[model samples]
Target: MSLTCGRILELTGNSPKVVVACECLAAGGKTWVLLHERHGNPLASIDFFLKDGFHLDEVLGSSEYDFELVALQPGDRLFMKPCQPHFVFGYAHSICLDPAASHLPNINDFDGLMDLLSACVLVILGNVLDFRTYRAPSQDEYEKANKNQQILIDHEINSIPISERFAICYARGVALRLINWIRMCSEIRGPGGFIITDLPSRFFVQIAQTLIKYKEGANASKLDLQANCTLGMLTKQIENVVEVDLKISSLWSKRHLIPSGSLALANQGDYSVQWPDPGRKKWSSIERDFMDAGVTPLDRLCFDTQHDRQHLELSVVIPQLKSRSSASQHPPKRTKS
Candidate 1:
């Protein structure tokens, strides 16, 4: 596309791609980019920004939003990461080619299969939420919304050609992953349920009695639990079977365990036993329960040993061992020998 002087493009986010300029840029050519880099949170819907009546330049310039300004010239290539929000401005008449392509990641075994699946899940989630326009509907509305989501999924799956075996497989994986996310988002008792309602509260989880550091040799036991049970209650149950003292220390789930604030202290064995704040007793006590962390059925849990007082410390004082400095200073009294 050719752009006149001072012409600016609107914001857009799509698959990863490389934009190559066909001709030399006249005088001032630049692209402003804002990337959604936080892995913990889902990508914000486009409607989220447009509906808020925000000016692109103003928001981009603000300190609250992190963005990058890139200058491009003749033969220059601008590589945009997956799902990044960006706009372009050309000072002079210039031509460019943008062919959206998938870039392979460093993983060799699956060849970035998980990344592709994640992108698919994001796309499906956007469709499920109707571009994030609505929130917290009644029971009837929730059921109707889910039905719409299923219809959309069916239409999408049918759109893929049957001959494309790889594409079919990908669509199936996306469907399964989407189901897991929908379940997590569904909290029926109150306004918490975003889409689905009245899910079962009882579930099974595998509890590993050993410390997380020694998970390889740990003995895992299965337990039944209710969604309303707190972390402190669960700890007591494990204590009865394991016959050991347990601390409200670091407990880990299958994929995520440590909170963002507790990451630095994890290595020091000072894991936060509570949610939001470690020391506060408010909000149903300090310890976070299964419902708060969204621990569904069949999720795995493990403990960290550093917080346990009974665990023996295995360390040898280096001063108690023979050293080159001590040997040089004493000389071992070799004359006696």
Candidate 2:
């Protein structure tokens, strides 16, 4: 197809192939653009989809929604749908790099937002909400997606990078929508002959545990939801069994390393020591002699004469050195005179 000179310059690909233009298509529509840089290099781009798609006619009626992320480049083509059925062209220009792009709605958009949403939340919920044809997207899934979304929203509120902000919002929206369906499940729960069942039928059971994870809010506000069935609760229920790994920084300069086996190989110890519960910053000579600046919890430690493994294993009790007197049951030599 060709356009009149007054509208757009027609091209036969003789010299200038990069035409700065605009295009639009509906969801699942496709278009092509020619990009050949006369100078400089081309950069990679990511796509973000809108949470809602509009009809060309519908958008003409209202200007409320915005594209998620914008690919800032001239000679760039944004292939998108216009409303539901129509598709058109939009060309990316280099001028979009300027702040003046605020004047143009198509300048900077979030195309990656769509994939981010699908990966973080949609993938988890879509399979669970699958129905015969049109499955109802559940509230639980929506809530879970929302947790991912809130991070994006926070970025917006905090003036974070535009790309990150858009990605988070799409994720959060998916999680929140699934939770809506979960609410529906609770309202329609029926008994299975009063024997003990959560659903009306064993065959039609819901994936309740997985669904409940959606309700966990990213914000600390969800802490108030202690008794409620939510993702955080499930995490907390098994927190102890899932040992948390906490790393510690060096207490001293950490310039010195402890030796292994006081009697032998005393200078060959490797690794660091960590004791967060120590009440004082200063250490006695005894503590310093035994202290390992690098690693903690060695297999054994010296106690005057003998190496004691009990000292390393015991929690509160400090290890006492065994002596000839302590080892004997009774004292001798005092009865003579």
Candidate 3:
């Protein structure tokens, strides 16, 4: 059975495409749609968003640029480039052509396909929310919740005389795994040394709540163990990225104090020198102290020489810092008398 929406329009000899339409209701907070790559970068697409007061942010390299909030009346369209990451947030509805559908054989069941697509998108949004609001539940609370959920599952299994429990369990497991994969991908830094796109943490929380509603309606079991594991991994990755980013930002902020000749050495390790005591006029003593410490004007020591993946990643961010330093008007600090 083909899943073609028949809403296909032909413009300028392009291949026919399937239309995916999404409507987001106002829930007192922002709603976001992030597209990291266009149909895996093989197909072309055009997006039409209902103007209704939405904000758009374009991701460039490691920075977010060109933020605009505009209201479009119905029937307005935006052209998107392949592999370019962009996101639209706020209450709105959008219709876009699916480039991935080009690879599929004829789709005749448009309604069914659309329903399936919508359900999948909704679940992903819910998973995002679950990830955003994830906190380590207390041991007691976790056990209690697990026990209660298990009881419910057992009751449902007994109610269904035919044994389909295994199928259901496997499906749930796959879903849990898929959610983990998505979380991991979302946290990964792209080639430009930035996350593919910035998503507000609360956005994922909202998605999780929505998914919970669906799970309740479907009477599906939650894979607590898998979810917890995925959450732990996500938390660790987030912490590591935050630490590195903080260090990079701090180094950039103090760039004015670093001499150009010493910048490369500083990247390798922290280098410190004792300033002469002006109050006591003890230049001779300061020279002797420097000699005792084996510290030269350009001497640098790698206190912690072990290189890790995080440090390697910082190499990409270093160029951006260098550019900022060059653009600054402040002169480098005088380190020598």
Candidate 4:
């Protein structure tokens, strides 16, 4: 099949190396396909649905590659090696792995992964900051606005500095790409296993701090306010992931080191099959480690001028006031007398 906006690569498995093409599909998306391609023969295809959501359907075109209509739900995955050509449909946010002609060495490279993650963070933040203008309004909404209103809206959107606009768009794109990478990593592991690692915790802190800095620097305008709220939510999500990873790592280190049978019994199940959910109280040491690694606290990172002023008044001004009052209560001694 002809490829557009997708990566084509040659991947080696138990069988001989073969080309793979992969594309991402948002909700309610479909792709056209050709049974044969000049790049390479189609080796395999896979679909991964995130959040236990969405449905995927596929239909084969050729009689030689006939297959029944199959539906895959959230957390449900489908894979076919030596895959036959077929038209694929996606009902939710999903990634499609197909045969391609080239190789992507950076896919597994640590530096490449870091770069991709950075790009995704930038995209997500940019989209959040200038969402109204970055994303076009729906047709229905566009039709409802009066001509004058529409012109005014457009003018206001255009008035935003070009530099800011570019920054917002770039951040949004990066965020999206990062999320796609996360989904792809999850899918590669197959079912009934956890992808345990400290990567998210290590990298997401910088992203969260960057968002906090942006939010803190933003003005009180409506757009800035909206962006700040959205960024805060995104930061919280990243923090949650980091906390969970810390918890799991702690448990894995402490519990998994024991004998297999004992560990299973202690966990009340297979240690590798499930992730341990430790309490929030257990996160203190991990938080300290993160701080040592230069991750600022979310509250401090998203500092507000008004809040800082209040804090200063309480800590510095109020204490001086109390000291003066106590001295006054002593009547300044009998010095005046």
lDDT of 4 by residue, 280-312 (tens): 223332222322222223222222433564588
Which prediction has more favorable TM-score, 2 or 3?
3
Error of 3 at 17 (Å): 6.4
lDDT digits (tens) for residues 144-213 of candidate 1:
2356544432223212222332333334334434334323432222233232121111101111222121
User: Which is the better candidate, 3 or 4, if ranked by lDDT?
Assistant: 4
Clash pairs (backbone) in predicted model 1: none
lDDT of 2 by residue, 1-337 (tens): 3221111112335743222233322223223323322222221110011112322233322333322344323234343331112233334211222112222222012112212222323322321232211111222322332454434322212123324323333433344332222222222212332222211111111222223323332222333332323454343322211111011112111212321111111111221122222312333222221112211111011121122334454533433334444657555657666
* Candidate 1, residue 285: lDDT: 25
Report how far residue 219 has shifted in candidate 3, in Å.
36
Q: Is candidate 2 or candidate 4 better by lDDT?
A: 4
Q: Which regions of candidate 1 are displaced past 4 Å?
A: 1-30, 35-56, 59-62, 65-67, 80-85, 88-102, 105-113, 129-337
The number of clashing residue pairs in each candidate reads: 0, 62, 12, 24
Per-candidate Cα lDDT values, in order, are: 0.31, 0.25, 0.30, 0.37
Rank candidates, lDDT, best first. Answer: 4, 1, 3, 2
Best by TM-score: 1
lDDT of 3 by residue, 5-75 (tens): 21322223464333322222212222234344322321111211111221243445533223333333334
lDDT winner between 1 and 3, please give it. Answer: 1
CA deviation > 4 Å runs, candidate 2: 1-29, 32-57, 65-118, 128-337
For model 2, what is the error of residue 234's alpha carbon versus the real structure, in angstroms, after optimal superposition? Answer: 22
